[model samples]
Target: MQKPLAYRMRPTSIETIVGQQHLVGPGKIIYRMVQAKMLSSMILYGPPGIGKTSIASAIAGSTKYAFRALNAAVNTKKELQIVAEEAKMSGTVILLLDEIHRLDKTKQDFLLPHLESGRIILIGATTENPYINISPAIRSRTQIFELEPLAAADIKTALKRALTDKENGLGHYSVTLTPQALAHYASATNGDLRSALNGLELAVLSTAPDPKTKTITIDLPIAEETLQKKAFSHDADGDAHYDVISAFQKSIRGSDTDAALHYMARLVEAGELVSLMRRLLVIAYEDIGMANLPACARTVNAVLAAEKLGLPEARIPLADAVIELCLSPKSNSGISAIDAALTDVQTGHSGEIPKNLKDAHYKGAEALGRGVDYQYPHNFKGDFVVQQYLPNNLKKKQYYEPKTNGKYEQAFKIQYEKLKKLLK
Candidate 1:
């Protein structure tokens, strides 16, 4: 049976592997290891179709080691033993273990001795974080390397390579891909090179040749139909989900409306209305606090509207909120002040509250000098009084460093500085 174009077009060497320059670029860690032939057991983790399998296969091909691929979850311990037997016969064998996070205890125990002996250079591939999911015994033996999602340019590079390579690609077919069609395959799949290449193959094979010209012309519409415009799904348990969420919040915080909308669109496509709603509320107070009070209130209203309307229509209100959030004068004063106070309390810096501030209504409270020194701020001028509010240890500690980014915060700064001066 013929293999899929993606499988057939796998990079057979480190230099040929596209993207992941941080790992496989010249003078990078993986490249250095390949150059030295000192291949160590390492865990490569990232989102799906982002060169995890390619890196493993490429390393084995480049090193000329007896390479064997097996799934840790599906393969039995006896299957691992067969790979071990091969390692023993050939001195060293490069073993690509897929789903290493799902590895059972028995298989882990069997692989441990071989990994330690340097007889099997274990390359564990996973979409989950090895530090969080894999056992310490397996983790301690391997160096973990994270693989990033391929760039759109990198995806395009791989797609072109597959189109022109005669041996393992669709080079023999007389297919013409327009630039627009090529971009759709690269960008629409969300950095998945495998999807782009497979989409290309589908476009080429399914398309018919021109009667006279005999050329299979793949236009933008054909490419889009072939991939059906892959949408990024939000997996609640997956690591990539959090990464996208993080980017969403940060883009709004950084006041990049375009980027904020981009990440928001991704969440919207995944039907993550609840997550987007909650994050907007947090961003409103934590990022836009005091700087634009009206924007914060409007954000609340937007979220409420979104909740009532739900998706399709929910995306509208959510987009409005994110745009205002991105353009709002940003401040972290509210969250920073609370966090500073929390740090002190958590670190045991909390001292006793002054006696005057204690509850005076309680029985026997007057005997202990509880409210004896307390002044009535209502009776005082400007409804203000100099009094110790914080614990004694934190009397001089300043937490709220207000930003003067907007008119609202400018008014707050004036009042805050006056209060500080009076207290001092």
Candidate 2:
């Protein structure tokens, strides 16, 4: 039996690795270290299917150091001790621990003394942010290398190899991928080579082989069926990022619960950070303004709590906050109103500060009729002295528009009406 395309097509040498030229290319930091035979303890941080485990394996194979692999998810303290004993006998051992973030503090601490002694070189791999997930003491002692997603071109090359390389690839079958079909596969994976190859293999294997053509054509529809989900259509760097976020914000602001949740699900499913979700929550308040003041507080608390609780459990609190924010009363332009007023002053709408509002420390200002005609609101009846606060060029501009929904807005509306009546 032949190995799967993903396993069979694994790059044995650094040169064959699809992505991450920054770390392993000629004269790069890790490349130089490896060439000099001075590889150090390190951490490989990246999302799944980005070659973290493969890179570690390649490093072990290329180096002369005694290599031992352990998974923090399965290995216990006793197993670690045994590995340490082996390292002691070997003098120099390279330990590659996968999913190192799963290790408890005690297990991580167990490796500290060995790591500090320079006896065992440790290389840890994690999908989470090292700053938050890993212990600071351990992180400080290791060099961190981040691996980026494989480019579409890189995935295409890997796909070609999978079709041609017989030992482990799809060489046994008559498979010819069309340009459109390959694009579909590449786009579906979103830079995950494993996913791309798996999808391609399934598409090719399932189709009936034609005797005259002797080739299986994998179309976009076939690939979609195999993958089950459409690829993320938005470009991460382009306007699509902002557009999606704007839609997400608007959905929440408009009180469209389904639309808001759908966008949230899209972001989360795309592997967006919890921190980004928290940021959107803050904007919901600043944009929503007084209409939903509690949304801001709720969002802040969710972010802080998510940091402590971690996912997949932390997702619950985040979801709660998202739903609450979407349902909260909406308001428009509190921060924007203040910002617009400041812009007018800076743009020379007001040539000088009002003398009444200016600092009293300027002695000449009082002599030049600077301190004139300013009514103090607190000293006046009902604390409601009506006076012009805007620049002369920008008068009677309304900034805040509160939506008539939810209890908070109702209360605000009542107070605003009462204040208007009293001032008149």
Candidate 3:
């Protein structure tokens, strides 16, 4: 029986691999390691279908080592022991452990000594963050490399290669993909080569050959049908969750509405409402600041409404809040101002308060010369009499640098500048 197209088209050499140039490109660490045929235990982590398994396979093929693949979800300790025994006889064995985060204590304990004694060279592949899922003992012994999603162009190149490789690909099928259909597959898979390849195979094999040309013709509609909604491999409890949220907040802070909406949709699809609400509230005050106080209030209300409504319905209000916050003027001045003040306090900036500024209403306060010449700001013009408010050590310190991003903050900057001159 023929294997799946994705499985058949897996790259067996470093040169054939696409994307993740940071690792596979010439002179890169992994490239060098492969070239030298000297590799230590390591973990490859990222979202699905970005060539983690292929890299492991390529490493074993290039080095001429005995390679065995096992899934932690299905394979047992007995299977691992078999591989360990084989390694003892063969000198060294490359074990490609998939879904390694699921490996239980028993399996982990069995593999620990083999890993330590250079018997099993473990290449752990995980869709989850190793730091959170893998045992610290295992993590400390391995270098972790994060494989990113392939770009559309990279996926396109791989697709072309697969279509023409006569020995292991769809070359014998006479499949013809239009440019539009090809682009649709490349982009619609959202960097998952597995999804793209599977969709391509489905489109080709399911369609009848055109009688005149005797060739399978794949068009945009067929491509769209095959590759449904872009596959999102976001695990709400994993690094992808935090990574997307971080990008979403930064996009809003950077005032990029499109990027903010993109990340927001990823979270929405993953049903991460609670985390979305919490992050939105934080970004509103931390990034938006006092630029538009009303915008901040609206975000809070939206979060409340989203919580009550829940998913499907909750996504609407959350999206509404995201759009508003992205368009709002951004300012980090508030955070900067507070942090500056905190630094002064933390660094021993405290000094005695002025005698006139001290409490004088107590019985003996007047005799002690406190409040002798305190100026009442309420009685002066603009309700802003010049007087020392900070401790002596920080008398001239100025924080709260206002931004002029929006009309509201423009007004603030003007007023703040005027007050600075008057007070000085």
Give lDDT tens digits, candidate 3, residues 1-424.
8898989988787887889899989999888998997788999998889899989888887788999999998999999999999998999999999999999999998999999998899999999999999999899889899999888788889899889988988998899888777776666565789988999988888999999999999877787678764223322222354578789999998989999999998877755565678899999999998788789999999999997998789988888889999988888888999999888779988788899899998899988999988999899887878877777777778988999877788898999999787666
* Residue pairs whose backbone atoms clash in candidate 2: none
lDDT of 3 at 421: 78
Q: lDDT for each of the candidates?
A: 0.87, 0.73, 0.85
TM-score of each: 0.64, 0.58, 0.65
- Clashes (backbone N, CA, C under 3 Å), per candidate, total 0, 0, 0
Tens digit per residue, CA lDDT, model 1, 222-327: 8767887533432222344457779999999999999999998887775556567878899999889999999999999999999899878999988999999899
Residues 1-424 of candidate 2 have per-residue lDDT tens digits of 8566786677766667778899988888877777777878999998677788677666766776777889998988898898899888988788889998888888888999999987888989998888888888888989988888777777888888888887778888888666666765665465678888888878888988877988787665676677664434534222333455678778877778788778767666544444246457666666555776777787878877877886556667777877887777666646766777688668866654555665656668667776567777899777768765555454445544545666777788788766555444
Best candidate, lDDT: 1
TM-score of structure candidate 3: 0.65
Pairs clashing in candidate 3?
none
Candidate 2 displacement at residue 406 in angstroms: 20
User: How much is 22 displaced in model 1, in angstroms?
Assistant: 1.1
User: What does the lDDT come to for candidate 1?
Assistant: 0.87
What is every candidate's alpha-carbon RMSD to the true fold?
A: 12.8, 11.8, 13.4
Candidate 1 regions exceeding 4 Å error are 230-329, 332-424
